[model samples]
Target: NVTVIDAPGHRDFIKNMITGTSQADCAIFIIAAGTGEFEAGISKDGQTREHVLLAFTLGVKQFIVAINKMDTAKWSEARYKEIIKETSNFIKKVGYNPKEVPFVPISGFNGDNMLEETTNASWYKGWEKEVK
Candidate 1:
């Protein structure tokens, strides 16, 4: 079953953390592809690790990582891969297999690689089953 929650980041307001994550079975983690943003989000002080760890602890085993705002990073595959490498390592540290994770390159504003595939992300492996 699928339920969408616009859960606030731990840094934003952690008061809702427990309630928001309690209902989730999986996560669509949207990290940016821009310079510094990706790094900052996964850093020790960032909410990404805390929130993801919380979800995992709460039994949210599935994950779909959406690397948003590819446009900002000029759709550089290098940048995408870089973030993926860093994130994959961290994800593994949290006890998940990096190979099973789906890291999608997207531009939320332009909807690149959302439904239809975009040339910008032509290298991305296409057509995984939608989350249901």
Candidate 2:
């Protein structure tokens, strides 16, 4: 069974995220490509802003980077690639092997590439099948 517990996203919930991650088998870090830092709520080190990023930075490779809100962004490939590159470098700085963790550009709100149908992200392959 997959347990999905939606936690608070504010700064006050940082502790909750740490605990949640500690007990979770896997996590999907959701983000928005168009909202800039609004999605992460952090800048500069990126770690300081993204509470979840902090989780992965502290060693949470069993997670998938879900780039959400692709629909609102009009499915901009450039935006997708930019965030991917930024996140990749951020992960590497924290001593993680980028290849181990998969980053998928998706639209959580529109169910894009989620559980419904394939999204506009045709330029990429899937990690679920690769893992299997």
Candidate 3:
């Protein structure tokens, strides 16, 4: 049985986030790939970095990073790679093994790479196979 909890990412709801994460076996971190958005999220004051560190501290051992908003970035492979490189480094610092994490480029707005492979990201070999 799988229970999925949608924890709020806003800093104001960090207490609620912690409560939810404490019960999670895995975390699916959704980071935006839009121009400048990714940078802000990974910045020193970003909630992405904060939540990731919180999840790690609370012992959420498994992580799947979904780099969303690919449609905004026009599904560029370079943008995907850039987010992966920077995010991998951040997660590594938060105690996650970069090799063990599954990074999937997605577009929640367009429904790409959410449940199946997206032609938009042809350059992105599906991470699900590697994860399993």
Which structure among the candidates has the greatest TM-score? Answer: 3
Question: Considering every candidate listed, which one attains the maximal lDDT?
Answer: 3
Count of clashes, each model = 0, 1, 0
CA lDDT of 71 in candidate 1? Answer: 94
Once model 2 is optimally superposed onto the true structure by TM-score, how far is the C-alpha of residue 100 displaced, in angstroms? 1.4
Positional deviation of residue 38's Cα in model 2 after best superposition, in angstroms = 6.2
Residue-level lDDT for 76 in candidate 3 = 91
Candidate 1 residue lDDT tens string, 1-132: 666777876465676876878788778888988878888889997777887788888888888999999999988988989998999899899988787788889999899988878888777775364454
> Ten residues in a row with the worst lDDT in model 2?
38-47
Distance (Å) between predicted and true CA of 70, model 3? 0.3
Candidate order, lDDT descending: 3, 1, 2
What TM-score would candidate 3 get against the native? 0.94
Stretches of candidate 2 exceeding 4 Å from the true structure: 38-42, 45-53, 56-59, 128-132
What is every candidate's alpha-carbon RMSD to the true fold? 3.4, 3.4, 2.0
CA error at residue 24 for candidate 2, angstroms:
2.1
TM-scores of the models, in the given order?
0.88, 0.76, 0.94
* Model 3 Cα lDDT, one tens digit per residue, 29-108: 99999889899999999888988999999999998999999999999999999999999898888788888889898999
Model 1, C-alpha of 49: deviation from truth (Å): 1.1
